[model samples]
Target: MEREKVIEVRDLVKKFGAFTANDHLSFDVYRGEIFGFLGANGAGKTTAIRILCGLSRPTSGRVMVAGIDASRRPEEIKKRIGYMSQRFSLYEDLTVRENIELYGGIYGMRMKELIHRREAMLQRLSFTSYGDTLIRSLPLGLRQKLSFATAVFHDPEIVFLDEPTSGVDPVTRRQFWEMIYETASQGITVFVTTHYMDEAEYCDRITIMNEGKIVALDTPSVLRQQYGTATVEELFVKITRPQRTMV
Candidate 1:
């Protein structure tokens, strides 16, 4: 049986003036899998995600997300993806329920469906008790969970999480990954970028980017075997250190 490709990129490029942020990148993310995007800062992970999410235009090359051509039909693609950025975008002053409602409305979900899904999300996160609490009042971990729940309120086919666990505590990070696993189990493709090496191991497969291009892509175990390293961190160091030596 052939799995459907939820995301497809070919020769994708993103340039800013004299700098190229993404240089002819290409990859495919299968449906219902967690695809990890790994790279050091300025490695173009976010740039590639932005283009795929229809948040930015690629400078050149073919890009398809959720079966829609990004360059020619970004608006259509936007409806199929949920994006959670590094910065939690929920309105701090709004209550938890309010924030969820706001995003549901933006996605044009019916009030009835929004209400039902909101309750289910709260139950899943064990956050029903905090439904009326202001988002600012919740602890950071809970807020992060809420932000993720809000992003997928519309049941998007794929979710883009750009450093969603950055600055979160170890316990909270574990909890967040639990949510991610649950989401993937429900058949939502999770495309996430993270700097944490251990978290990279959690992905079904990972792609390592260097200098705006994909330098490595494979299962975490395969990557470790190929690099003769015990961990993703070591592999990252091995791949990136040579680049540093040149400078």
Candidate 2:
């Protein structure tokens, strides 16, 4: 059986005045796969993700997210997708449980359902003991986990995580990826953007962006083979290097 495509983008373009943030980008994210969006800072990864999340409009091209045209029915698409931004978008003053409740309420989850999910999530993260701790007081790793859990509190079909593991220690980053795997195992499609080349290897497939254009798209192993490099970092350097000639 063939896998279903959860996200479809065709010649997607996004421009801000004279600047093009996403230039004719196109890609597909299959259901139940971890799709990594890799790029350096200012490579347009965030711009592209924003367009797909229906948070911003594209200048041209077509985008269908979760079977709905993003430009035409963004609200419908919003209901089916969860987004965790790079900034750890949680209220610092609020307790972990309160933050979860806030996001659940926004998703329109019933009170009883929210309570059940809240318990499960806290248990899964071993955060039940700190349920009442203010988000600002928690360590960075715990705060990141809480942000991720809050984003998917209502169990959306697709989740977009933008640089979710930035600033985390290596051990914590590994733990975070394990949680991502757990989420994928539950049949949720994960669309993530990160600057960590090693993490790209964990993705089922990855798309690398350079100067607002997609320069490489393939599985990590295939990308390594194609670039004749041992790692994604080496591959990325090769792919992004500009041609030079002796004068």
Candidate 3:
């Protein structure tokens, strides 16, 4: 079966004063795929994502997210997408159930549906009793897990995750990816940006950004074979770094 294209960027560009942030970016993200967007600091990944998420305007080019033209209907696009970042975005004073209720309310879920989702999420995260615990009392990993659950409570078609696992332990990171896989399995397209090279392999397809432009875009396995590198990390280095000259 052919999957639908949920996002399309054609020659997208963004600038800050005189400095360009995203330079003629173009790509199509299919539904139900974990699309990894990789870049170092200042590589312009966030700038392009901001434009896609309708939080920032691009200087030029066409960009569509979730089948809506971002430049033309940013508000509609925003309504159908979810966003979570390293900051977690949870209200510290709110408990787990409260946090879910808050975002579910914003998404306009009904009272009955909201309760159902809250219960399901609490059970999934093993937070049945912790539902009443304040968000501030949770550890970073638990906070991030709740953040992920909250972001998807309304079941957005595309969820933009910006370094969602920045400082978590290895086990927590692994568990987070399992949640991402479960999301994708439900036909949600997950857009992830990360500094962790190994995590990129978990994505179905990856686009590597360097110096405000995409230097590589393909499956992790294909990129490894194409670059003759053994790992995603090595392929990334080959794409971003200057090749050594044979002596």
Candidate 4:
């Protein structure tokens, strides 16, 4: 069977006054795949992400997430998708369980179901002992994992993660990618952005951007071969950085 398109973007653009953050961007994210979005700071990745997640409006273009119109049906789209921002969003004062319950409430989960899920999640995450621990008390890595678990607890069709592994240790970053892979295997589309070129290689396919336009899109292996580079890092430098030419 053919893979399903969970996110569709065509001629997408986002502008702030005279600045165009996303200039005629276009791409599609398929179901059950990890789609990496990469760009330097202020390269329009965040603007486009906000538009796709329904947090911001697009200046012009067709955008859809999980089959709902992103422009006309943002609320509906929100209900069907999960989001984890670069800034961890859980309440710092709330305990591990309380944070889960709070998000569960936001997702409109029933009390009984939430209770059941709470225990299951804690056990699955090996967080049972930290049920009463405040989010501020948890390690950054643990907090990152818990944030992801809460985002997907409501069984969203897709999950948007913006720079999920920034500031994390190498081991923790690997663990986090394992979770992303597991989520994809379960048929959930994963859309993520990061600065680490190594992490970019973890994505099944990636879209590299510069100045609000997609510079390249392909699997890591293909990109490397097409660019005749040894690594995604080299490929990124090749695309986004200026090259010195003989005069």
Candidate 5:
């Protein structure tokens, strides 16, 4: 079966004065995909992501996210997607339920529907007892899970996770990926950026960026085989840091 394209980019470019952050990039993200956007520091993947999220405008070329023209209608694009940053973008002083209500409102969900979904989400997270607990009181892993849940409160067509599992314990990270898989199984496109190579392997397909351009893009297993590397970590190092790779 032919997959539907949810995001389409062609010759996308974003420049900052004398420097170019994204350089003529082009890629397609399909519906229900777990697309990994990988890169080392200063690779311009962040810039590209911001553009795709409609948080920033691309300098040139076509960029469509969820069928909206990201460059021309950034605000409209925002309504169609969800974003969870590494910081877990939650109110430290707010109780878990309050924070969920806040984000649900921001996503334009109806009050009654928000309350219903919020309760269901808490139940699913095994967080029924933590509704009144302040976000600051919860552990990092729990807070991260809440952030993911709130980000998708409106059930967006796509979700952008920027290092969503960073700095968590291995078990917590595994649990987080399970949520990601469940989200994708429901046909929501998961666009994640992670530095952990093991997490990269969990993605259905990944595109590696270097120096503002894509250097490698494929399934983790295919990338490993094509690069003659046993692991995605080795493949990442080989592509992004050739100087550290030995012949």
Candidate 6:
């Protein structure tokens, strides 16, 4: 069966003066798949994501996200996707309910629908009592969870998560991935970037980038078999070792 592609990038390139961040990149992300975008620092992962999310325009090549041309319809693309950055974006001065309402309103969600969805999310996270709690008062793990829930509040077709579980404990990270799985099951494409190889394994498919190019892209099992490696971490180290050595 042919899966529907929700993101298509062909010969994509992004250059800042003399430096090329994404060099002739091309890929397709299927509908409802948990797609992992993996790369070492300075590998252009963030640049490419920014372009796809309509925060930045690609220098050249075709990029389509959620059926909108990213280069031409950047604002429209923004409406169809959600983004949760590495640093938490929730306002510490606001209560959980206030943060949710703020983002929901920004996404153009109505008051009635926003309230219904917000309550459901709070209940699902066992956070009904914390609705009025200021974000500054919550723990890091709890804050990260709320950030994710808020990002997807308006039912975007795709959500981009950059190091979504960076500083949390192992147990909290595990719980975070469960939420990711639940989101994918609901047919929301999960586009995540993580340094954790274990979390990479949780992705349905992964694309590894190095030196402004994709060095590997495949399912975890297939990528392991191709590299004759026992784990994704081993394969990642093997593939990116040369770049690490050069630096």
What lDDT does the true structure give each of the candidates?
A: 0.93, 0.92, 0.91, 0.92, 0.92, 0.94
RMSD (Cα, Å) for all candidates, in order, is 1.8, 1.8, 1.3, 1.4, 1.0, 1.9
With candidate 4 superimposed using the best TM-score fit, by how many Å does residue 202's alpha carbon deviate from the native?
Answer: 0.9
The window of 10 residues in a row where model 6 has the poorest summed lDDT is: 238-247
Candidate 2 stretches with Cα past 4 Å from truth are 242-247
- TM-score quality measure for candidate 3: 0.97
How good is model 2 by TM-score? 0.97
TM-score for each predicted model, relative to the true structure: 0.96, 0.97, 0.97, 0.97, 0.97, 0.97
* Model 4 regions lying over 4 Å from their true place: 244-247
Q: Which pairs of residues clash in candidate 3, taking residues 3 or more apart in a chain or in different chains? A: none
Residue-level lDDT of model 4, residues 136-244, one tens digit each, is 9999999999999888989899999999999999999999999999999999889999999999999999999999999999999999999888999988988888574
lDDT of 3 by residue, 1-247 (tens): 7779999999998989999999899999999899999988899988888898998888899998988988888999888999996566899998888888988998889999899878988998898989899999999999998899888889899999999999999999999999999999999899999999999999999999999999999999999999888999888877887465221
Tens digits of per-residue lDDT for model 6 on 27-72?
9999999999999999999999999999999999999999999999
TM-score for candidate 6, residues paired by index: 0.97
For candidate 4, the 10 contiguous residues with the lowest summed lDDT are: 238-247
Clashing residue pairs in candidate 1, if any? none
Instruction: Please name the candidate that would achieve the greatest lDDT relative to the true structure.
Output: 6
Residue 202 Cα positional deviation in candidate 1, in Å, after optimal superposition: 0.3
Candidate 4 residue pairs that clash: none
Candidate 5 structure, TM-score to reference: 0.97
- lDDT string, candidate 5, 13-82, tens digits: 9999989889889999999999999999888877888899998999999999999999899999999899
Clashes of each: 0, 0, 0, 0, 0, 0
